[model samples]
Target: MTSTTERPEVEPARGGTHASGEPADDLLARHRAVAPSWTSLYYEEPLELVSGSGNRVTDSRGRTYLDFFGGILTNMVGYDLPALREAVTKQISRGVVHTSTLYLLRSQVELAEKIARLSKIPDAKVFLTSSGTEANEAALLLAMTYRRSNQVLALRNSYHGRSFATVGITGNRSWSASSFSPLQTTYLQGGYRFRSSFRGMDDDAYVDACVADLRELLAVATAGDVACLIAEPVQGVGGFAVPPDRLLGAYKEVLDETGTLFISDEVQTGWGRTGETFFGIEASGVVPDMLTFAKGLAGGYAIGGVVARGDVMDCLDANGISTFGGNPVATVAANAVLDHVLDHDLQHNAARLGALLKDGLGAAAQRLDLVAEVRGKGLMIGLELVGADGYAPHPAAAAAVLEQARAGGLLIGKGGLHGNVIRIAPPLTLTEDEAREGLGVLLTALEAVDAAQG
Candidate 1:
């Protein structure tokens, strides 16, 4: 006897409407219902991006905007590069997406060799991971184990990543969710200058003051056995806060005396984004003990790694493995990205276009009271929003500008401890035309924000 058991009707997938002609609103409603509360969304009405090509992305409603954020600086060569696509396709045909680090992978070895050659670290060795956070974790582990200390020093208003360990090192309070951490971290001064008490000082005095502060922090805040001092040459999430070009070199002097490892968090500032140097720390004329990188190297694929002095890298005695680290597909994508970055000389383009963008942004700042300062190097620029008081951070103005820019068919990013700085980091492949268009839209947005505030 065949029993007819009726199955209950299944609801549409959470965060998405059913195929029964439901509108996109249902998808958003579902999203709110199922997504984590801390998952932040941009704009008052969050956009649903569906497609992208080159430097532009299309929203669910079919409106296209020039993507200046580059998916938070991860899309190094821009979206859907023909060469990268071809490489990824070829890798996919190989029938192996992932192989645990237990086995050898040809692409991983080639990518590591290329990065080691380019890293500039003496006798460099590379270890791959799935993201910047993991790379930093590895770096921290290597440093602590090598030096046999859990004490670390980081810069104020700096951001590393969101992992438990990385967040412990992050000085940005907004991004840090918990105070509890395994490593004891000491916060130092130097990364953020605009809001510093030493802002009135000349460049030389400022550098000396920052170094003195670092020295004090190391002496007072940390025990005698500090393991490492990690810093972002250009603090990415801290609104691209850039100190004097020689700041890290100055800090390295003190670190050397203490036998502390210096780890440069180049996750955002690597791969020639800064134009003047392939790695941002190179501008300081100091070679870091270890360098952590991610984002741009993989051309939108998940890949991160640490390049360290061979001796330091070998200090980790125990077994460590990242299941998806150095996966075949990601390595291929990264290798292709490196080729494109070098072949096209994107770094030089970044330097050339960055100057034009900065000039335009400076003009906008001069015209608009809302724009307090324009700072950053190469293609990574930041505009700090301020109120009529001239020095007070204007987060509302920043929000207004973001919305205005999006409405004007431009997409950008925001950061800073107070969330008042506009982060404009387009892909390295950004052209003169695209830069001009983005600048025009940004200026218009600034004007709109000023009018709104008034």
Candidate 2:
């Protein structure tokens, strides 16, 4: 890496203006100087996106790329959306902007109502937080208290968050910060069959085996006093690994008898990203006891929350609050996002365009041996890269295609248990033309990697 003062030689961005502007690396160098070493960034040469509109973002170097990853699936509708900006600015303009949840906030209440209606949890009660990690922590607080148990269940290859408690439950060791957790967490088999014991089984058989395994684990591993079973319907950071249909429903069957709560972490798969339904868990045919949401919920706002029934949510016999959770501006922004998503029927857009993209990528996997699997639904898709033998994970190939896609004016994401899965999740407002353009660039990138690595 170049020292902070050394300006590396740079190349111009294609189809970009002012490409020779002051070195874009300066900001990154400054960030490295102050930010924690563990705070990671994307790409070989880190990109500083200065502005965005619709489904694209322009870097400080003046290069633009179709934003397929949507800022890790946070920019739901797109960047610089007029409606969201207006609502947020209007909220900001109103007086002191007092945000602590200690006081009653009309905007916060309204947003909670919308989420309660949308979350699909029976008799849902909402609690807002600043991020998905905190939202999940809140869920854990409720579940563990309600059930009077600290034992929790999660899936293999899962990633909940980096917070202390969440890190304990996270099965993806790559994202774990520490091994210690207050809650007793157990890992169960899910639909990420590539690295699973039920790899070759059909969907029905796979679900059966996983459910059986879970029952046995709970019996042998614990005293049958589990608090909750939390999962991502579509494993987002785990490379968009979609569990088999009815898998969660089957697990819910066992949890029902054990009095164990079910929490669906929708941080990455919420807001129509999966296309099949509004919430990713809806497709699984199991209504969760609690749902944790963040990322794209309020467009680009830093907001997340949990929803559960009144009895479960009120189990804590103490008062609590968040300094910024459900703040006026973010909540109003989320209300606007909900309005936009509902009025424009953007979920249908995600369905239509997402289907097109998935079909195209599926076709690419047909002839490309490097692509071991094409899984996930709608816009939340994954391409699992493999080595020459077509089974071992090829993280190098994933990295090469990521760089190639950036060069081709497309920005995507990479994640998996082994970092070999290419994640594709675009904005819900993406047009058909934009969708086709991004698909073309991705296909070209895949072809380039296939030729070099196959």
Q: Over the stretch 1-454, how does candidate 1's per-residue lDDT look in tens digits?
A: 8999899654554454423334445556767878999988889998887778999988876789999999899988888899999999999997989887999999999999999988889999999999999999999999999999999999889888889999999998989999999899998876688898788777788889988988788778877789999999999999988998878899899989978999999999999999899999999999899999999998989999999999999997788877999999999999999999999999898899999999999987887888888999999999989988889999888888899999999999999999999999999999999999999999999998888777
Best by TM-score: 1
Clashing pairs in 2: none
Per-residue alpha-carbon lDDT of candidate 2 for residues 1-454, written as tens digits (9 for 90 to 100): 8657767655433443444564333566677877999988889898888889888999877888999999899998999888999998887787756659878899899888888998877788999998999999999999999999999999999998988999989989789878889989999987588888789888899998898998899889987779999999989899989888799999999999978999999998888777779998899888889999999878988999999988999899998888999888888889998899889988888889988988998888999988989988878889999998889999989999999999999999999988899999998899999999999999999999899874
lDDT (Cα atoms) of all candidates against the true structure = 0.90, 0.89
**TM-score result, candidate 2:** 0.94
Runs in model 1 lying further than 4 Å from the true structure: 1-25
Q: Count the backbone clashes (under 3 Å) in each candidate.
A: 1, 0
Give, for candidate 2, the lowest lDDT window spanning 10 residues. 10-19
